[model samples]
Target: MRKSEYRISELLDRLARLNQSELWTNDLNPAQVAALKYLMAANRFSRAPSHVADYLGATRGTVSQSLKTLAKKGLIEQIRSAEDKRSVRYDVTKTGHSVVAIRTNLDEALAQLDQNESANIALLLSNVLHSTLAARGGRSFGICKSCKHHDKSANRPYCRLLIVELAEEETSLICHEHDSAA
Candidate 1:
C-alpha cells in the first residue's frame, strides 16, 4: 500500500481501538454496545436480528448472543411483528437510550472540530465506507433520506422500495435496505 494509505488505515485502527475500549462500561461489552447503538439509530424496518447481523457484519449466532445479553440487562426488548408472527424486532429500552446518551471520549473530541471540518471529515469517511462496502458486497445501511428509494417530492416522504409512507423523523434514520442515491 502507499504510505498515505497505510497511515490512514493505521489511524483508523487506532481510533477504533480507542473507541472500543471506551465502550466497555455499564457491565456491557463492545458488541452489546454496538448492537444497542445500531438499534437506536435504525428505523422500524431494520430492527430485526437479521438486520442487526447484517449491520454489524457478524454472524447471526453472535448477534443473537449479544441481543440476549442486552435483553437480560433490560437494555432491549423483543416485539413480535404483527404482520409476521415469526418475525421478531428489537427495540432499545429507555435504559438503552440513556446508555447511548453517555458521551464517549471520541464524541467529545469530535465535538471540538469546527462544523465545516467535521462535515468534510464525515463526507470523506462516508465515501471511504461506501467504497469499502461496495468492494465487499456489503449492505450500505445508510440513512433513509439518502437512499434512491426515498421520495420526498410528495406531501409525505415515502419509500418507493417499501411502498409505504415514512414519518418525517424516520426519513433521517438508517435502513438495512438503503440503496445510495449516489
Candidate 2:
C-alpha cells in the first residue's frame, strides 16, 4: 500500500479504538451504544434488527444480543409490525435520546475543526466509505435525501424505490436501501 493510504488506515484504526474505549460510559457497552445511535438516526423503514446488522456489519446474533441489552436497560423499545407479526421495529426511547445527547470526546474534537475542514473531511471520508463498501459488497446505508431514489421535486419527498412518500424528517435519516445519487 502507498504510505499515505497506510497512514490513513492506521489513523482510522486508532480513532476507532479510542472511540470504542470512550463508549463505555452511561452503563452501556460500545455495541449497545452503537445500536442505540443507529436507531436514533434511522428512519422508520430502516429501524429493524436486520437493518441494524447490515449497518453495523455485524452478525444478526450479535445485533440481537445488543438490542436485547438496550431493551433491558430501557433505552429502546421493540414494536412488532401489525401487518407481519414476525417483523419487528426498534425505536430509541426518550432515555436513549438523552444518553445520545451526551457529547463524546470525538464530538468535541470534531467541533474543534473549522467548518470547511470538517465538511471536506466528511466528504472525503464518505467517498472512502462508499468505495470500501462497494469493494466489500456491503450496503451503503446513506441518508435518504442523498439517494438516487429520492424525489424531492414532488410536493412531498418520495422514495421512488419504495414507492412511498417520505416525511421531511425521514429524508435526513439513513436508509438501508440507499443508493447514492453520486
Candidate 3:
C-alpha cells in the first residue's frame, strides 16, 4: 500500500482502539453499541435486524445475536410492524436512547473541532467512504435528504423509492434505498 493508504489505515486503527478504550465503561460490546447507534439514527422503515446487517455489512446471524442481546438488556424492543404484521421491527427504548446518548471519546474529540472544520472533515470522510464502498460494490447507506428519490415537490416531502410520504423526522435518516442526488 502507498504511504498515504498506510497512514489512513493506521489512523482508523487508532480510532477503533480509542473507541474500544472509551466505550469499555459501558457493559455492551462494540458491536452492540454500534447497533444501538445505528438504530438511533435509522428511520422507522429501517429498524429491522436485516437493515442493521446490511448497514454494518455483518452476517444475519451476528445481527440477530446482537438484537437478542439488546432486547434482553431492555435497551431495544421488538414490535410487529404496523404495515406488515408478519415483519418485526426493532426500536430503541428510553433506556437505549440514554445509553447511546452518552458521549464517547470520539464524540468528545470531534466536539473540539470548530463547525467549519467538522463539516470539512465530514465531507472528506464521506467522499472517501463513498468511493471506497463503490469500489467494493457495497451499498451506500446515505441520508434521505440527499437522496435522488426524495421528492420535495409536495408540501410534505416523500420518498419516491419507498412510495410513502415521509414523516418530517425521517427526512434526515439513513435509508437502505438511498441513492445520491445528482
Which candidate comes out best when scored by TM-score?
1
Q: What's the distance in Å from true for residue 122, model 3?
A: 0.8
TM-score of 3: 0.93
lDDT per residue (tens digit) for residues 66-119 in model 1: 999999999999999888899999999999999989888999999999999999
Question: Model 1 lDDT vs. the true structure?
Answer: 0.94
Error at 27, model 1, angstroms: 0.5
Shift of residue 135 alpha carbon in model 1, Å: 1.1
Top-down lDDT ranking: 1, 2, 3
Cα lDDT for residue 146, model 2? 88
Runs in model 3 deviating more than 4 A are none
> For every model shown, what is its TM-score relative to the native structure?
0.96, 0.95, 0.93
What does the lDDT read for residue 29 in candidate 3? 84
In candidate 3, list every pair of residues with a backbone clash.
none
Candidate 3 C-alpha error for residue 78, in Å: 0.9
